[model samples]
Target: MTLLSLFTQARTYLKHRPYPVLLMAATPGSSFAALPGAQAPTRGTGTSFLQTFQNYAFDGFTLIGLCLCAFGIILVGRHALGVYHEIHMGKAKWADLGSTAVVGVCLIGVTIYLVTTASNIL
Candidate 1:
């Protein structure tokens, strides 16, 4: 609780830093190693935690994009099927197909945009 105790704690922490700390000083383009098992660093690659975070974040974004695409496909399929049934029964006009197409195109565009820009977010 006292300043001396805090100083002592800090001193102890520094004295017993793990082995990675020593290795990191010699590693290129990194303050510390990235997530364990990440590929070795190259020209633009890195062993920093930031790179690891970006990799994980990009994966999360990709998963979200995949889910969105799946949902979009399901939505478009269901809408088209319903409209087809209506047309067969003489309850719907051909113009409804335009709306369904528009919805699908818009979803595709949005997903493409998000996937392309997701990396820039970090």
Candidate 2:
């Protein structure tokens, strides 16, 4: 059939899947590993609780910062397009376009800062 209908059928089939059963089947030891008093798995790095919490918190903040930066880029791009159109129609000027470009560049720069800070958390 058509591509749209095929995608619709696939989406419908996947939406109602038995996720827990599939997850259990995917991991052969899932059911047996749910023992009482079982120790949770660790990477054996021996980091302290406070250090781990700091790492996780910083990582989450970095992720959120990066996401906001990307969203800013999208907003700037949309606004820049409108500014350009307005300039073309004589409703605005080149200064607005330049400002949009500057803001867009600054937002993308923040994304780079976030990525770099991920290695220096705390």
Candidate 3:
């Protein structure tokens, strides 16, 4: 198969599971984990009902970011599993598998780099 076709297939797969991509792209405060400890907020300070509500509302971004990161990880894992299954079923060539593996490794590496480097600028 042509490289274009392979990309088209990947696009189709992503289209069918758009949430992961969306989450990865749009998660709010996702870089909080990479912030300096002093810059990060402490938990459990708000005890009053209104204070609690405000805290939850603002802190929800961090929670969403965390969830999105988890979802993205699961999605990558599923993609790898799908590729492996295709190779096992003889539906994909060995070269395709090798290329896919390389791409997967690069993807994971980039993801790690992004998560590790994400900070105020991000």
Q: Which candidate number has the best TM-score?
A: 1
Q: Compared with the true structure, what per-residue lDDT tens digits does model 2 show for residues 61-121?
A: 7667678777877887888899999998999989889988988888778767876776465
Model 2 regions lying over 4 Å from their true place = 1-46, 114-121
Clashes of 3: 0
**Candidate 3 per-residue C-alpha lDDT over 1-122 given as tens digits, one digit per residue, 9 for 90 to 100:** 99999999999999899999888887667866677653223345476877766656556655565566677777777877787788889887777767767787777677656655553222
**Model 3 per-residue lDDT at 44:** 53
- State the lDDT of candidate 1 residue by residue for 48-88, as single tens digits: 88986666666777778778777877888888889978988
lDDT of 2: 0.75
TM-score for each candidate, following the candidate numbering: 0.50, 0.48, 0.43
Candidate 3 versus truth, CA RMSD in Å, comes to 20.9
Candidate 2 — worst ten consecutive residues by lDDT sum? 38-47
> The CA-based lDDT of model 1 is what?
0.75
Task: Itemize residue pairs with steric clashes in candidate 2.
Answer: none
